[model samples]
Target: MYYQCFFFLQIDRQFLRISTVPLLSTFFAELDRYSPRLMEIFSRKGRQAGKEITQIMDAISKDDTIHTRRACVIKSLCTYLNEDPEKLVKAYLDSDFELQSTMEQTVMGVYVILIEGALPDDDPADIAVLIEGVEVLSDLNSIAQACALLFGLIYCLNLSYPQQLKCT
Candidate 1:
């Protein structure tokens, strides 16, 4: 799934502006904009959710380089969610199912962040609904999902790339 996203991004570099940037940069950028909104929703849940939000916010806001910040946040979130970062990262890198559960959570977490940021004026409670809204997208496979996600992200952020979409 990760590689599907990677290759999809690679193929749509003009649309995604991801050709020369690390994936983490895009994640961090989106998180920077949307984590606060997530925190707002989670905080209403109770003390535990508030604490979880704090941990995620801390990881996102840490004053470090992009790569380090991503690692920290991924590590912190995985740990808080009761998964081993070492194992998950390894499995994620290896494209294996060992980290499938954790990876799914992480992907959902990211999508939530993206959705929240995308619809800033909407209620955060609608995240699940928003996700469901995209369920009818064609080609329900990893590459297709990645392509749809990238396009959704571009639409959400109103991003403009220097290059034009072109076939190789």
Candidate 2:
């Protein structure tokens, strides 16, 4: 977990320092907890990290919402780390992270977990679990709850809301 945080910190620095695009400025600023050592590691591995950061920036191009943009960033970072989003999600569910009591609440919990990439572990499984969980959450009665789930899925998949809105 410590190393994972460090890794993100370095990536955050690289994104902020080199990229001319300021789309993620606010997002990166929120990660100030990571120290300068992480920035040093990023400097040392400039070639590789540079390529990954470029990919991340490209991913953010299609997103309008911060939720969706951050999701793309996480997905790109996962690729850089040789990790899969689905596997990371499953591992998060299996860990001791706190979950809500009801199934609906639990679905919301999982939605938040996957969207945030809060877990730092590996477990392989079909991504269907995540899809199903989000679908279930989307079916709940409250409009607010349903919207939250929908936004969570959009973020998870890095979907363009404007494009989808046009399609609908």
Candidate 3:
């Protein structure tokens, strides 16, 4: 539904071990995607995207692996959800002229659609469907698949790996 992300950066170890409640509440479901404080704690590790982030993603199986594409998709999905209602996609395109000038990857970001904040329904199963599509998607679909997979990881897998994600 409503989407917002809490970014934690460059943290040292002393604060990393504190109770993870504040970190977990961020996600509407399965809230821990490497808590912000963890990042503050583990900045020493540098940015190890996939493995580092994955280490705390969940112990269960990963449905897809699109670590490299997350940032772009997050931007796109954010843009999509925030679009003006009357015009729909066309208006979104018109209003986002800057998007046309963006790099191809940026313009075509993928993300899982989470519904909240006065939306019709916020079913986690819908998020599950997004996850299932990941492995089978093609190029264009990959971005969407990746986003959906992330939603599944956060919603379905209830673990916190704030120490896992790395920006660099």
Per-residue lDDT of 149 in model 1: 46
Q: Which 10-residue window in model 2 sums to the lowest lDDT? A: 120-129
Off by over 4 Å in 3: 1-29, 32-37, 46-98, 103-168
Q: How many residue pairs clash in each candidate?
A: 0, 0, 14
The sequence of per-residue lDDT tens digits that candidate 2 reaches over residues 49-158 is 55665654463355444444444444444444544432322222434355433222323222332334332222122112223233233123222222333444445445
Top-lDDT candidate index:
1
- Go through the candidates in order and give the C-alpha RMSD of each one to the true structure: 15.2, 17.7, 17.7
- Give a tens-digit lDDT track for model 3, residues 1-168: 432221122111112334333332233233125334443343333344433433433311333233322322333223333332111111112234453233232212232232334232222212111122232221222233334334334433453422212121
lDDT of 2 at 100: 31
TM-scores for every predicted model: 0.27, 0.27, 0.19
lDDT per residue (tens digit) for residues 14-56 in model 1: 4445444445346456755654464455445446544654564
What TM-score does model 2 achieve against the real structure?
0.27
Which ten residues in a row are the worst by lDDT in model 1? Answer: 124-133
